[model samples]
Target: MSTDAKTFLLTGGRAPCTLELARLLYHAGHRVIVAESLRHHLCRFSRAVARNVHVPPPRQDPDGFLSSLAEIVNQEKVNVLIPTCEEVFTLARGSGRFPDHCRVWVEPIERLTPLHNKWTFIQEAGELGLQTPMTWMAASHSKLTEILRNINGKFPIILKPVYSRFAAEVYLLRHPAQPCPALSVSPEKPWIVQEWIDGRQICTYSLAFEGKLIAHCAYRTTFTAGKGSSILFTPIEHPQLLKHVEEWMASKKYTGQFSFDWIETAEGKLYPIECNPRATSGIHCFGESDRLDQAFARPETASLILPQAGVQRMLSLAMWSYGLFSVRSFSQWRNWIKSLLAAQDVVFRWRDPLPFICQFLLLIYFWKQSRRHQISMLEASTYDIEWNGEY
Candidate 1:
């Protein structure tokens, strides 16, 4: 390893995007360490990860989590702390406790809080002159009914937790007879009901330093695990979408990884649906390019650039297992096969095959967690892992 190379401590090991980030950093000669809430995640077996430490879920024990991270940073001389999920909020809140030498890759709490909350984000974006969906907050079932009764909108109202990850528990109400099911929502965990806009779904994952955009990649989610997690990523571009994101990031001086779900109407208008103040699947769209390397090493100096086109990184195993059954046509199956043949597995590397094989074990872990939490596989994947600090 180069003496000039830096050390990064990455969190949220359960996520493929997070593991991909670690691979990029490690291949660039930087030390990569991971902090995972689960004991048997794929990151635990990655060759790129120098160390993997199990920690308490930040949502349940924020103080203990922060303490563990601080100890690791000081002991290992970690140069940067990178959070790859909603846990970013917890780290950002307690970032002061880390040593001055260890740079936490996140925006300050004052700026981050609003972006993390769905209702607050939409309101703030509207105030900033950005186009946003009509959103209302509902802390209980009664409040949700009241919002539904008041809004004179058409069918397919979108409802989701105000502070959520992976589109978990997101519902589309099409008929009046359908009841609003508040699965995990409470007074502490409110839900947002927004007027569903019909359009093409586009998602962007970006990194910024200070206020300037450093690296940006946008992709369309062609296939998804139900309405939740995206299973396939195809590179795409839209000048208007890029412009809107640049403006939003510049306005907030966003200083870390951020993603936004956008809907482009038929009339060529853009409305931001919601924002994820963390890395998303779009990160996998970028291969290890020089532009991206420069951004990771010294973002303050790197010029803004798009990711290069290579073999698209995908979760072929998952797509083959569960996603194949939903394929509606022969052309779709053929395209999937072609993509699978041309692409590399997201978690598998020839040099590090254990992590790829170990990823299957995560299914077992997810099953147990789902049973314990009484949520679906999608929800269990990020339930305790993501911090919901809305209260």
Candidate 2:
């Protein structure tokens, strides 16, 4: 390695996006280390990762997680510590614990909390004069029922938790055909009901430094595991989308990842729906060939870069399991096949193929976790690190 090479420590190594980021950083002449709570993670066997350091689960033991990260930073001399998943909140909550030499790539908990919460994110965006969905919060079951009754004859609405991910527990109240499902909402665990707009859903993933966007990509999932988690990611960049995100980030002066979901109308209007203060699948859109990897390598001064055109990343296993069977029309099948043939499997790199073979064992781990806890595989995948105002 060159003398100028910096060591990067990344948490949430299980995510495919995180694995891609590790590959990017490593390929950019930087040493890569992963600190993960899960033993059987995607990056565990990747050649891109120099070392896989097992750390305590942040949700269960934030103190230990912070301590372990601090030790890793001090010992490995990690130049940057990036939390790629929901554990970013944990890192933010326990800030100023890492060594002075290391730069933790996360904002303070106060700045991130509102952004992570579905209700507060929209509210804050609206307060900033941004276009947001018509949203209402219900702190109790009765309040939710009342809101539903008031909007019973109105347009369809999206009902979800104030803090959620992967579209978990999100319900679409369409019309008389679908009855409202009973929910256990409370003041402690509030939910949101928002007017569902009829438009194309566009998602943006970005990295901002001192409130300036450094890396960004706008994409839409052609295939999702269910109604929520995307399995196939295809870039759909637009100037309007880029401008919207730039304005949002510039206002916040954010220093970490900020991913948002928006509803784009036929006339090119975008309604901000939700924000995730961590890395998302859009990171996979970034390739080393684009030189966008240099942004993370030296975020302080790197100019803005985007994912080069004609980039698509897919989880083939996910597509096989959740995508193929869902295809009802011939056109959908054709699009699916076309994307499958064109896109690269995020896990199966020619130079680093161990992760591809080891991933079956990782799926087995998630399966056991799901069975043991009686939760869905999606829930099990994030159960260890999900921070929902528990602090």
Candidate 3:
């Protein structure tokens, strides 16, 4: 083992972002162990991972998940434990269970999970000195109906569950008179109605230590799986934008991975939509380099790591399957070609290629899960790990 290298246990090995992160850490001379709920995942076949541990799904069995994680930390002598998915919430809730030697890169549930809540995040972001979209929380059917009546169709509105991933439950209201869909709106599963902004979607993925930023990357999604969840990340550089977002996060004294979704209007004003306080595809915008690794491993001495210029990343499989269908016009086709030419597949590496080959198996896994659960394939992907205010 390298003298400077540390053993890292990263959760959510099933996610492409986690696989890419493991590659970055491994390339930097650190040992990476992946803990996932699924029997098969992308990292299971990757050369970057040193070990793969199957643990109970964090969303389904929080106690069992924590016990397995604690055992892994003590036995493997993990130096750092990073949660790369919604599992972050469960781990954050049970953070004290781990032994003393391991440093878990997550905030406490109280400080962290609030950011995951759409309703609270907007209010909190405003207090923290960031522009946020106008949002209203509706905890009951009566409240939701009243909020819709108040909107009066002045402009478009979007209703989404306060705790949802990938815009899976998003509903767009084009007119105020349209009857709202029947939804479970209660204290336990509240919804937020946000004023729709016409602008470019600018998303960020950042790693912070204490109140300071270690690495930051802002991206405008080029291609997406559906309405949300970008498959291609086009890194953009705007000093002023990055500065404001970084200062906003620094004000929270935030630690761990803090990511955001923002709407940048034609006038260049940014309105933050929600916060994910966990890893996102923005990780793909970065290369397998030591800067990000050093930032996570030794944040004190590490300088801010930014995305490499002119670099774009995509899920090549999605480009063919989902992106191809997205093209409807000649201009769209041209842009699609440009994006395809400019970006590299996030998974495929010429030297280390087994993981890329095995990605098909992971797809099959999701297919089986979707069929068994009678849900959308995208929902099935994170069904086991996604969190929604379960205590």
Candidate 4:
């Protein structure tokens, strides 16, 4: 640790991206304090962690939780408050409660609310002239039917909640014959139905300072599910995408870390999915590009440097980690083997392997837990609900 280290308080410590962010900051000689809503996996993986406080769970008592966090920020003399989860609005809205001495990097409340709301985000993007998917909001069964009839949607359409955290309740109606069976469509709680564009999924990671894009990078997701982080990624350059990014930040007056997802259609058109106003899962590619250090050193630095061929090597190392857990299917085993061999070609280096090793262990633990029915994808939200009354 360095003597002149600054402290950063990170929320949602249990998220892997949050832990990785802490590791990057710690390696850059910053003292790390994690204010987590849960102590399970985060407490286990942080090697350079200075302190870990379990705040009131987010969903239960957002207001009280922020108040408690405000007190901690003052006590710890935190230099920056970094939130990694969907509870960003909760913290940003309560920013005034914290002492002015602490700098919380969040968008203004007015902007934060609309940014998190999917429908609002789409409208805002359209207003800003950014290319976004054609989205229609349906609040009732009649509206849903009407929207479906009017659009005459093709076989595959995506149905998602107006305010979704990750891929919760998102479904793909693969064919018209399989019209979305009325599960539950509240008039007040509308759902978004959009043409499911076929294209490669790419995520752009960026940081803004006073509405200016200071740091940016884009990566293609090689393998991803609705909820999990990308298993593989490749860095790429798309100037048009960057153009929309600059316009978006300028329009929103965005400041702080944020990410936007895009789908590059077969026709070479880019359609914006939505914006995540915080750090994203694909940020690991920063380390691979050797630009991770620059983000910590200078917040104003912005560049889109592609990763060297060494990325494959890093993927191989990751695959080796997977193989240690007895990933046995022929295709699965072969993929791991390919990654192990490919890792030899990458230049990205893990400064500290402890956290990565711990992450691998946790992945295996969760996998086993799933097989035993201890946890289900749909039931994951219950964890937040359990603390609802506690706050």
Candidate 5:
């Protein structure tokens, strides 16, 4: 470990991504303090966390969140503020408020808004000479009808909000006669109507600093919690795709962590689908403490790769329990058992036992919110928690 250790303030405590980052920073000899909106969260219980502070939710109370965070930065002498979830929207929106010494590890709100908005992202990608699907933006049902008539693609169009996470409220339409729920798009918020492309899903997590790709890891999601969240991650090499990402980031002069959802057609054409301007679960695939240290700060020494080929990192609890009840089969059961025995659960570290024990509290919280909101268990966990700048 280096003698000059930095103090990091990580936000988004309820996310497993935060726990993974805490472990990485702590092992690299940095003081890992966590600030969270929720009272009970996995990252708060982690032994890696040097301190835990509570704050008002960024989406619900932006001013309060900023004040609380400013106090924490000054008191802790935080060297950096890293947001691990959608709350990055709020943080980026108030980027100028943080203390001079504390660097907020995200792009400016101006850059983030387009990338966070799906409709805007597609347009921006196309303008940048990147491959993007034909997408139409709609602010109302009437506008959607207009787009439908002019669209050049076949049936099975994909519709989703311009800003959302975890694939919430995404819809696939097979025909005009199919019952479609009314979209919530308006002048304030918009929706995306895209040509549904058939291809393999490829996801990448990259850490960029001042337009340079310092470190990155690409992987295929072996299993997913829903249409969006990956439960199991298996890392792979995609040199061309990575190069494309590098050039794209350099062109935009992008900074901070970015996770991209992409589609690769059968002919090997890569089309960027959407961008999440925050950390994702792919960090778990890079398990080395020293490598993470270099990836974030010591970029000169960093060489990023999967810990090993064919290795699996998973949220075992979600995969096992959800797999057993949702879709029971001998093959799936065996795979789940194998994942439990062979793969590393991002939340469960034997050295940090309390967080593993306390994780169940989140499930209970999700369950209560799910019923209260009349949503699915997955949506309940993230619906209110993830602020897409919608409100």
Candidate 6:
């Protein structure tokens, strides 16, 4: 389907992935409107966006946030609202506020809430016969102790909030040395404790139409920490991994774009880690496959071949090397020097430079501000700066 007549609204446009997605949509002939909360960054980085609207950050006034979004949808006649972050939750819950003329792509709240909860996800996936890590949900000291006693094996278990918007309160428990660190106090809220799987981190990005997988690509994480999606290396299709993904989607009747993180154990068995119902950082790897058009299309399509192993490996290495040089432990001056060199490296090497350049400048600004205690890591993660249509 041609996107010529379509107007797309991208939420969380400040995210590097969202910016790249907007650029792709624009190149494909869709008029793009970027909805962001930070005016300064948006004004500087989002010049290519056909329109920009500054809304309250999602963390504050989530209920009132949709009013501004609805205004944009009305003005632009947006056909599709693609959310790139937790901001999606506000839009999804406020879907009723959207004009009847517009279509918002999101999973139903029933499915979405369950999927977002790690404990619920594990239970549901297990019931569906999908391979998932052993999981327990605990909300109090008694429950936590029970879970600890039950696990006979490892030391470093994983503790995560059942309904975390982002990767907040995620801990790697090395042992029962202490309590689970009270992720939340409310008795109504529970966290998931699961056996940590040791293996290679692999991911699949796919579009499913009516429970049928149309397009798919898989990649391996080259660098990742508590914060997600640092870098990844694309790989050719793995039939086994594809099989598991197809089964899970079919069972759940999932539609739209979804990504799954899996671990390949020593026995060569693939165990599901977590599932993200929206577009993920691994979507960048799809560029290697050339199947990105299928993702843009409404319905499912074909599997695209990614870059050869050599190219993906090289790119992964380049990014890692750059990270090492650019990210220092304590030497602030050296970090800045290395970052400048890294920026030059990326500029000369990136296929598309404009978005990368915008992102680079924003990074430098935030890095400087971070050192001054202007923005915490959590705040930085939610940045939504606006650039006033200036390139």
Please give the lDDT score for candidate 2. Answer: 0.87
- Output the lDDT of residue 136, model 5: 84
- What is the per-residue lDDT of model 4 for residues 1-391, given as tens digits with 9 covering 90 to 100? 5665678888876566677677667777788888866545543545757888878876777877888798889898887788777667677667788777677778766767676677888898888876777888988888889877776656478998786655666788887777676657786577889888899888888877667776677777653433534445555677888888888787767787778888898898888887778777655555533645454445565453334433432333333443335455788667656655554312223644455555445555546555666665433522452221011
Tens-digit lDDT track for model 6 on 121-216?
A: 777778877677878888886887777887857667988766653455678888777566655633566777888888987878776766877767
RMSD of each: 2.0, 1.3, 1.2, 4.9, 2.3, 6.6
Model 2 per-residue lDDT tens digits across residues 100-134: 77888899999999999888898889987888778
- For residue 213, what is the lDDT in candidate 2? 92
Q: Which should have the higher TM-score, number 1 or number 5? A: 1
Give the lDDT of residue 11 in candidate 5: 90
Enumerate residue pairs that collide in model 6. 38-384, 38-385, 38-386, 42-385, 42-386, 42-387, 43-386, 43-387, 43-388, 44-387
Candidate with the larger lDDT of 1 and 3: 3
Model 4: worst 10 consecutive residues (lDDT sum):
382-391
- Residue 270 of model 1 has an lDDT of 82
Tens-place lDDT per residue, model 1, 207-271, is 98877888888877666777756777766877787888788788877798888888888998888
Question: Clashes in model 1: which pairs?
Answer: none
What TM-score would every model get versus the actual structure? 0.93, 0.97, 0.97, 0.81, 0.93, 0.78
Q: Which wins on lDDT, candidate 1 or candidate 4? A: 1
> Lowest-scoring 10 consecutive residues by lDDT in candidate 1?
288-297
Task: lDDT for model 1, please.
Answer: 0.82
Model 1 TM-score, 2 decimals: 0.93
What Cα-based lDDT does every candidate model obtain? 0.82, 0.87, 0.89, 0.67, 0.81, 0.64
